[model samples]
Target chain A: MASPGPHSRFSARVGGTPASISEAAGQVMAIAEAHGYDKAARFAVRLAVEEALTNALRHGHKGLDPGTPVALDVEMLPDAMRIVVEDQGPGFDPAGVPDPTLDENLNRPCGRGLMLIRAYMTEVRHNQRGNRIEMTYQRPAP
Target chain B: MPSPESRLRVSQDAGVTLVEFVDRNILDEANIQQIGEEISGIIETRPQPRLLISFANVDHLSSAALGTLITINNKVRNKGGQLRLANIDPQIYDVFVITRLNKLFNIHADTSAAMSSFQ
Candidate 1:
């Protein structure tokens, strides 16, 4: 992996396991901050990346070979940063996820990843594979 | 065997000190303060730029835990160190992200990566 510079960007390949996802998140955060992103922006990127990666591990690649790896591609733009998380597991319908805040599901222990991703990032979308999630955050305007 | 509550334990691991709570209820304010103090004390004594925390046994964390994490993160950074979380259950990880805390601290998948942070 290339070290993040003033305009640093890098990509890392990690296994699609819950354990690896968290490790990957830390690596990404370090790179972002090393590239000069402010604290708030760094936090946003980390949260989004973590959530997306978790989804890939738990949902995207749920029962497949534990050895399957997830690909994390990150790019730091001048005004925004983008991350793409791809998994080889069976894809699902993104729209099927329920709103966590809904009265019925409010007390449930799961189903909040999407909400968190939406809250922390400026943009979030699922790719055709349905197993790939793309999240983007634009630095707060000065 | 003993009662379920009796089976629950909270031990302090020196390598990556963690307070494991087995209950599912939300953490209250008082507990947060106590945990923060312990974490602070760890930082004061170790003087390491990074600390690894595990939430493996904690099933649910309250907003109080979130606040404690923020306080710890700030204090660690002020001292030129960092606090990293590890083994956070998927459910708890969701809470961190939803509350936007997953960003505030450096979180790792397990203790090894967090400990390796200083290298």
Candidate 2:
């Protein structure tokens, strides 16, 4: 197939460790820079991805082996990026997550990861199992 | 004065403790935890700590880091201290805005403004 205008894809079974998360996020961001995504977009994608991976290992893989690896998929397009993160742990209801923006919850730490992932990504979808998430960010057409 | 293990550069100006990040990205678990512990240690050193955390060097931060900040804010408030964040990059500041943490924390444009508002 002919080049699709800086199209690129990366997939990995990333470890649950912090170093692994950083490495994976860095790779995704390097592609973002190479594809000419602006700082804001890179920040958004990085934050969302980090939150997703951390949540996967911390919450999804809870009580399981700490060495469990989560699935990460990144597709960098000319004007957008799509990312998916899936963990082996049982998934929970995204609706059940309390709103961190609420007055009562504002002072409380934790629970902002999913909220952020939603806010930054153009679109977010969770698999029926809830263990898998697919997020997309589409840049405005110039 | 920052310890070798610290992710923050800590100092005092007047009565306020000015804290800056040594790392460009505060997005990971270990880094955020260490930063939290270091700031919390500062908070514990004084009865009424006036802390100004500047994000001049932080290029990215995750929600976990935000959680750590909240924890620090709680500790500061519990001890009658104050916490102010300054010099946040516009992109990173949007993370605060998106999560509505701007309402939860006292944020300022720069260190000078944050330090002045300490009292």
Worst 10 residues of 2 chain A by lDDT: A1-10
What digit string (tens of lDDT, one per residue) describes model 1 on residues A1-142? 4454555466877775544665677678777777677866765676677667767766787788877788888888887888888888778788888875655554344566677778778998887769888888888887
Task: Give a tens-digit lDDT track for model 2, residues B1-119.
Answer: 45787888888899988999999988879988888888888888899989899999988888889999999999999998899999999888888888889998999999988888876
B113 Cα displacement, candidate 2 (Å): 1.0
Residue B13 deviation, candidate 2, in Å?
1.0
* Best-fitting candidate, scored by TM-score: 2
Off by over 4 Å in 1: A1-7, A17-19, B1-119
Q: What would you estimate as the lDDT of candidate 1?
A: 0.67
Candidate 2's C-alpha runs over 4 A off are A1-7
Candidate 2 falls in which docking quality class? Answer: high
Give the Cα lDDT of each candidate: 0.67, 0.88
Pairs that collide, model 2: none
